[model samples]
Target chain A: MKTKLIITTGAALLFAAGVLANAQRDAIVASLASQAGVSSFNADAGRAMFLGNFTGGKEATPSCTSCHTNNPQAQGRTRVGKVIEPMAVSRNPERFTDPEKVEKWFRRNCTSVLGRECTAEEKGNFLAFMISQ
Target chain B: MKKLTTLVSAAALTVASLPALGASPWMVENNTTKSECSDCHMAYAPGFLPERSWLAIMNNLSDHFGEDASLGDAARQEISNYLVAVAPKELRGVSSIAVPLRITDLRWFRGEHGSRLRNRAENNPNIGTMSNCTGCHRGAERGFFDDD
Candidate 1:
């Protein structure tokens, strides 16, 4: 009985910690979204960055939607140019969080598509729009 | 004996400095004016971009959307080298942009981009991940929209 109680207590603590962290993240996202003024992603940003829509990643380049769809609950792109899997909030088990990763890809994708850094506000807004989804 | 000792000590110092000297030369040339390419991008996407991405960006400056944001061939190459040379490890601390989910990583991007879509929707090169491809597309650069 004592052991059972201890395990339950431990689980509760872990759960509480998780909740706290999540709450903190949501708050941050909300603030960032509010500041960015991004109502919805519309995946317009992605199309602008993709090679397809731009037809600019060289004549052979592709677009952002070339891989990841309007709904991120899907897969992303690869190095050589191929589909991988789905990663939308519902599809991909644990997604979101990590400014660094977001920054890295935004940087890479923007360059891959746009050929330049996206700007923090743009990133923040993009992020907010994403989380809202 | 004393002279030899000094010589050895000097040699040791040089060896230690080798690591620093061995680094890519661009890191040493990091100047505000040099990275001017970041004027607009500094706020858009700071240290997140890697060298490869930077190189690609600089290379595409000419047709950078419809703005003719072209760079001199040499300058473009230099910027590309610098980005890869100085970029740090990815630090994903939040989930999505708003919340740092218990897990942090652009899984949404990864999940959506399973493979490269090669089909052309009409004349436009139809891609899978539109959001991931804006920065340079004419349609997107002209208007902040990446959805297919």
Candidate 2:
């Protein structure tokens, strides 16, 4: 009976941790939505943005998939052969938890890949897609 | 008298071997420099380049080798200071006026890594670029590059 009780408590704690992580992500997404002047983000649009190709940026990196790969759950490689961690929140729980880091990457990568800063709406959609993954 | 002679010879030999022991490993001691500089590539030892080279690189991080590696002002300043403080005043075979940006362009580096090795690195997917020192020198991050 004691072992069963411990297991149940462990599961509950894990669930609570998951909820807390999601809450943080939700707050960040909410703020992004407010900035974007939208009520919700679209995961399909995010996925399309992740896979779309463009010629605005450097010839080497035309799309997010150029480095991040198509599967968000899989590991990615940088242009210089560095290994990037999986982007999926399920695979890497720490992702999208820090708003500063999230914004930093967006500011740099959007300019690099799309040759411009990503819109607040686009950022929200991308985060929503990654969170869903 | 023989004992004294042997001791004197041993001391002389030790003194002679000091220069032959070579320079100490170029380990990055600063936490901020290590973490910030190593985000994209291996954090190269500052000893490989001159202070001016580091200054040039740090000043133009927005176009760091064709990548937008711009950092926050605080981090940028901290890393730049650390690098300049540790970098060599000058390197051999490089002109005083020249500010070499790539370590691979150094004379010592070219002597160590010839075209054959360069081709191998370029051809191999596992070792995509010659800049990826840790690809062959597994202990590069720890300042040990002798394994290769």
Name the candidate that leads on TM-score.
2
What's the TM for model 1? 0.40
Question: What is candidate 2's lDDT per residue for B20-135, written digit by digit as tens?
Answer: 23433286767778887887788888888889999999998866786677789998888887776667788888899999999888888889999999999988888899888888
Candidate that would win on lDDT: 2
**Which run of 10 residues does model 1 chain B get worst, by summed lDDT?**
B95-104
lDDT of each: 0.46, 0.86
TM-score of model number 2: 0.85
- Can you give the TM-score per candidate against the true fold? 0.40, 0.85
Q: Candidate 2, after superposition: displacement of residue A99 in Å?
A: 1.0
TM-score of chain B of 1: 0.35
Relative to the unseen true structure, what is the C-alpha lDDT of residue A92 in candidate 1, on a scale of 0 to 100?
43
